[model samples]
Target chain A: MTETILKVDNVSKAFGALRACDRVSLDLRLGEIHALIGPNGAGKSTLIKQIAGNLRPDSGRIEFLGRDVAALDTVERARMGLGRSFQISAVIAEFTVLQNVVLAVQGARGTSFHFLRGALSDRAVTEAARLQIERAHLGGREAVRASDLAHGERRRLELAMALALRPKAFLLDEPMAGMGADGVAEMTGLLDGLRHEAPILLVEHDMDAVFALADRISVLDYGQIIASGTVDEIRAHPEVRRAYLGEEDAA
Target chain B: MGRETLLNAAIALGLVAVPVWAHLAGEPFIITLTTKAVILALAGVGLNIALGHGGLISFGHAAYFGLGGYAAGILAHHAQTFTPLMSAPFIIEGTKFMPVIWLVAVIVAGLAALVIGALSLRTSGVYFIMITLAFGQMLFFFAISWPAYGGEDGLVIYVRNEFPGLNTLDPIQFFALCYVILGLALWFSHRFGRSPFGLALNAARQNAERVQTVGIRPFRLRLTAFVISGMITGLAGALFADLNRFVSPSMLSWQTSGEIMIFIILGGVGRLYGPVAGAALFIALEHFLGGVSDYWLVFVGALLLLVVLFARGGIIGTLAGREVAHD
Candidate 1:
């Protein structure tokens, strides 16, 4: 098997009496699109949050590139080439789309504090930002304010921002949550292309997009993985059908 | 090419021309008033870094402003007495100039910012505001209680400090000095807003979690902005001491902090020239209203409430409208 880029070992999280995440274990491999699917409140976001270093799990270990990263902060993990796109659109509303992407490029370049020269005037930073924007199909939208962009374009901008980091792996949460048919197709095509570059762990509810794009599918129920297998195996599994897909597939 | 640059240059030119007109028209008081406006505006610009761009409501900026004023005052007092600042450790005397006083002010304020920011950054929202206010009150009391160079009474300068080859005693010339520094501070604030570090600071304000996920520490970025903001305000304080030839505990009061915040809000929060516009309006209001009635502050307070309620953006913001870029 290809080397595992990420390993979550028996991670559990609790808040008061609720076990938000319970002993969830998973492995993500190199250059593969792995999908984590579940009903609402099934703890998929919580798991993603833990993996992205936003929240610490009560009991678990996360290993990335052979080192345990449970103690690392979010930014430190990002600097180590871990990129995450938020479930909510979190672009700087006042900044131009190009400026937002440039910030990410600057972060990856490790020169966020260079004060004498204007960041806009820096040729290398702008060029890299432009390249990432183009790669994410946001070529013409560069001059628009992030707030002015359409919801789908904003989602694309978030992806462009993540790509700007030149990340080793991507943790994407609902890239297609609010997209229409055209938006979904465009984003699916983009993700399909990115699968050749870095490992991607996507948390999505769009089963059609998930099955079409994911190399491996994991069904999460009540903060626990009920089933994990290839598309065919997940489609054939009775437990997954009883818990999630039975009603939907019947319709 | 950007609208921000055009507006900043326009304000700078207006300020530079004011003293020239004062010099020609034989109105020396105009020059003094202009200098006062410029100095206070520069202080506002400093506060704008934390409040506008960084989204840090530092209600205690008067601490740095007062510290700067005291540095100039204490140094000038010791220089006149022909007393070394320290004899047992080493011999250190005081010199009066725009540069030396500014340096001392910047260093002192920067150090204080480091300590205050470390503590204040621990909390956010209302807690942050209260913590900063608490720190400002602490310094205000300390300045009032210390019986060194005037205490509650105030310190008076026999002569204005000198700048190299500039005569320094002429009111118009002094106005020109303050105008140039204000212009520089405005430019610095504008440039800082567009820098990479500035982008992160703005990002942190918008979304702290997003910034962290991108691999940037929010606290460190904010702390850096806070220190730079304090240093800039401190420089303005040094000039302010020379403006009135006086330094008092009132300079460090919470009222002073509120006034600085008012300058940013009244002009247009986060706008490049917001502080300048706000400073000009505030001084003009003070001059005009104070001449008309002693109850002018009541009107000022009413106007501030109006701005906070109806006009979310200050005067420049209302004039410029919401489409103006502010980060």
Candidate 2:
């Protein structure tokens, strides 16, 4: 594996009596798609939230770029090249798609504090934003209000924004949750191309997309990893079958 | 031309034209009435920055307003009596200069906003509103207890403060001073709304989580807007105290805070001239309706109810038509 870009060491989180993430450890290598699959309430979300710096883990540490990031908040982590896509598709609905992406571009460049010069007149920010939007196949929809876009288009817009940061690593939480069949296929193709750009930590439910795009798969059940290996290895793992894919699939 | 542009021009022209016509006809009282509208509109513009653009509903802005009024009253008091305000270090003598008073007013208000915003912005929704209102009331009660400047009875200025190259006591000249200030404020608000900082603040208001994901701190953006908003309102408060030649606790009341909010809500929230339009309508109703009956506010209340129910975008948005979607 290439140099590990993100390392989660024995991370754990609990809410009251229920243990959400129990000593979870995972590492994402450069230019690799690491898929995390689990049943509902498998503590997958808890782990992702901790890594994204949104929730504080009770134990262990999260290290990004070989430095401990346990003290950082979400915005600090984001500024340090940790790009993320929200599961519910968070976006400023009042802003135009171009403005939304431009806001991200400005953030990445650390020039969003400019007050006097009109942002609409800035060619550099506008061009960079346009390029990201175009890459997401949203070329003509730049001026469209974000809320007016279709559900799948909003997902694409979110991806475009996430990519605008030129992030070293991506943490996408169910990016395909609300997409239709064609949109899913299109997104899978898009993500398949994006692996060379950066490593992606994908937490998804679509097995076909996971099997097709993931370089390696890790099965999570009840806040613990049952199995972790290459796609075919995970496909043939007997314990994973009984725990996740079901015994009938193994037969 | 687009409807918004045409209506904007008309509003600007109407505000100026009526005052000019009344001035030439030798009816100076009409000019005083229009000047009242202009000054209140200036206060509304200040509130718009926090409420409309920054999406901070500060129910305690009257604190700055009252403070600004007191700053003017206190300074003029010392200047008129030929007494130095302080002697411990160097003597701090008060001045009758309007510019100096305005500077002090803006700084005092800006500082107050910084403190209140720092605390109140930590909460949101109804909590934010209540915290701000509580702060205003705290100051209000303090002003009532402090009898040095007349306390609840209020302080009065015998002569209006001086402005360079003008007789400020003259109604027309005073109106001109206010008119020029309002125009500059309007222009500033216009340029500010489209700048990067303003856009980021707007995004923060709409979805703070999204802003954080993009690596921007919503709190910083909000605090900056709040300070600027307070300074503007404070300037208006100084002028307002000058307008009545009096500084009173009524200026700091929660009812005054509600009135400022009414100006914004009755105008377009995000529109540049919303406060101007709202202020004009309010002044007109107060003057005309109050002249006609003892209970004119009932009619005004009914009118406000109608606007809130049906015209959600306020007078500016209603007249401008739906925003034309660009290709």
Candidate 3:
């Protein structure tokens, strides 16, 4: 078995009287793609937020690479090689594609205070950003403003930015949420290629994409995990069949 | 390398030539007016860091400006009596050199910014504006009631403070000093706008969530920019004190804060030369309109409202037809 890179031990979160995440626990290992799937308001986003250090869990422990990361802030977690992509595309609109990616590289390189020299003109920085852009299939769109990119292209740019950090683990929230057929395919292919590079915690609703890309699927209902298994095991589970898959087949 | 650079250089050269002509034509008042314009523009450039690029509307910048002026005023006052600042274990006496005054102004204002930013950044949107305004008022009241250095009436230097190898009393020479400092501050603002930190600051303004997800803390970035902004404005305040040979609590007033913001908006927000253009236009309008009538501020207010409603992008922004390309 691959070594576990992330461990979430019985984490729970609540909003006033409403339980957003209830006793959720999951482990992610190297070289495996873990998918967390649920209906709307299933507390998937809340759970992911806890892991990304944007929200603190009400009760539970989160350990990353054997360190207790429950108290670290978002930027601190990111600096420790935990990369996240938002559910909504969050690219800087006014900045050019190259500048956006270069910022990501700058974050990783620890040279944000270099004021005298132009950031774009730095050979090493540009080379690194160029490689990441090419990896995300944004090689031809380097000079284009992020605002000018198509919807699908913006999604890809988000992925490109996350990858630029060279993270040890990736927490991707709905990488294909608003994407069309072609966009989904491109994203799936990108995810397929990324499985060998780092562990991925994917929270998505597209059953077909999840089953195709996820090595292990976890079904979340009402903020609690109803079942967790391989794709065949999840497909055979009676509760999952009645609650989630049945609605999909009916549609 | 770009048309923007050429235009900037031309404008700078034109400004430098103005005082030279004034010197030759024996118009000392013109030199004084130009000096005032340059000093105000320099201060505007400082505010532009937070206002234009960082998207932080700081209404308390006048506090730093006043602090700088007070630094100059207090130093010159003490220097005349040869009094020690502490008179204890460490004897720190005052000096009248521009460099010493500028250094003190920058340091004090930068520290003030750190405190103000740490507190003001806790709120966003309209709340941020109000908090900054409240801080500015606090400083203004302190200066007015303190009883030190002439209090509400203001402190005046008997002579313009001297600089090494320069006649500080000459109108044209003093104007040249103000012009050169303004030029340096403008260059600094331009360079800061293109740096990595500046890019991140702009990113934070555009999409703060995105900037955070990429591992940059928005609050820290904004605070840093705010401090730098205060330091630059504080330097300008020192220059202004020298220009008028006085320091007053009026430098800390909310009206001064509003005027600084107006300069940026009237020229074009976020443009490198916007503050310069805005300052020049504002001073020119004040001069011409004040000469024509005593109630010139009413016209100025009307014009500002019109610009805000119809122009949207200020004078240079209207002419340029595009946003300044940052990062």
Candidate 4:
């Protein structure tokens, strides 16, 4: 049997009175989009945070490529091939798009302790970053500041940065949240091709995209995964239909 | 030439010209005054690394400055008396060599920054500012209470430390020594500002979480910046002590920190030559205004208020007209 690329084991996180994630278990296989969809306050963001190392789970283990990552911080986890995109658009707003992606490229390598040489002059890293930027369809906007970018463009820039990391697994939180109709279609096509490079654990509210891209759909509700199966199987699942979809068909 | 480069060249020339012109005109007082300004300018350069580039508003930099002064004063004092610094298994005698004094001052201050930065970097905003200030106050009060050196009175070196072939007693020669160091530091700062590490640091200042996701630890970058800041400021402190032949606890005071901050704010926060212009302007204001009335601070306050309200980037920014892409 082929080992899963990412494994999240019985992760549980509780706020004083509210349980954010309760014994949630999932696995991501290579070249597959495992879409996790839930209503508001279903703990999607909290679960993503745990995997990204932004928050510590009360009792659970996250393994990337078969290595336990409980001790690693977000940076260390990222260095170990766990790429993440924030729910909110997060980019170095003061930096140009090229500069922002170049920083990600520089970090993709080992420690960036080189103090004497200029970063812009490092052609290899800058060239690689340029490729990712182009891949994200941001070719002509290289010199534009991140702050000045449109909402959809910032999302693309975030993808450019995450893709630059060359991660084995992607934990993207609400990647399609703020996108407009055209932006959504464009990003949907991008994420479709992206899964061929590495497995993705997508947490999005876009059901159309979920139906289009997901190899498997997991319905989350009130800190628990109510159901998990292929899109066809999940649509027919009574608990998922009753608890989450109501009458809006997933098909 | 670019605006920044032209401004930098002008600053370097102007700082050097003031003392040389003053010496030839037989107004020796101006040379001494300029020397003070240059040394303080170097200290401001040091702070700019952490404050401007790193964006760590370290309000307690005077701790490193005063520590550097004490390093020189303590070593020179021991050397003059021909006493060993310690007498356990080995006898370590102090030397009146300027280079040795500088090395000691830089190391001592760097270590102090490491300790303080390690603890203070964990807290940010007003908490970080206060922590650094508290550390500075601790050192200031400690220096005042320690009677072995001179306590409140401060320690004095009878003669300035030797600088190999140069005449240390001659004001112009000493100024020349300090001027060369300032030049080297400015070059280093320019190189460092362009480095990849510097970029990551600037990024960290803007967003630490994003920096972390990029696989760079913002804490380490900030800590290194703080240490480098301390080392450079410490060297300036040693030079300043040599100029006055005095090492006082006042060097570590928060007032000294405020004055250092004023230099950066008045010049341009992140601009490399910002501190130099600021220090020169501050010294000029002091020398010219001190003769009029002792209430020079009130006017200084007014000018500072004007700069803060009208000029966001300081003198260099005003002269240069625009900001560079990366800075």
Indicate which candidate wins on lDDT.
Answer: 4
Give the alpha carbon lDDT tens digit for every residue of B1-327 in model 4. Answer: 689889889989988898999889987788889999999999999999999899999999999999999999999999999888887899988879999999999999999999999999999999999999999999999999999899999999999999999998888899999999998898888888878888899899899999999899999999999999999999999999999999999999999999999999999998999999999999999999988999998888999998899997899988997656653
Residue pairs whose backbone atoms clash in candidate 2:
none
Of candidates 4 and 3, the better by lDDT: 4
The best-first sequence of candidates by DockQ reads 2, 3, 4, 1
Model 3 pairs in collision? none
Off by over 4 Å in 4: A247-251
lDDT of 2 by residue, A118-195 (tens): 766789888999999999989999889998999999998999999999999999998899789999998999899888
lDDT of 4 at B197: 87
Model 2, C-alpha of A208: deviation from truth (Å): 1.4
**B1-327 in candidate 1: lDDT tens per residue?**
555556667777887787789899998988888889899999999999999989999999999999999888878877777777667777888767668888998999999999999999999999999999999999998888888777898787668888997977899878878887887887788689878888889988997887877778889999999999999999889899999989999999999999999999888888878889889878889889999999888888888899989998787677666644433
Global lDDT of each candidate: 0.88, 0.89, 0.88, 0.92
Q: Per-prediction DockQ, in order?
A: 0.59, 0.65, 0.61, 0.60
Q: Which should have the higher DockQ, number 2 or number 4?
A: 2
Error of 4 at B261 (Å): 1.2
Q: What local lDDT does model 4 show for residue B103? A: 98
| C-alpha TM-scores of all predictions | 0.97, 0.97, 0.97, 0.96
lDDT of 3 by residue, A1-251 (tens): 67999998899999998899899889999999999988899899999899999899999899999899987989889988898898988899988889899889888777777655777888898898989888888888998899999988888888888998999999999999888888898889999999889999999988889999999988888989999989999999999988788887677
Candidate 1: which stretches are off by over 4 Å?
B1-10, B322-327
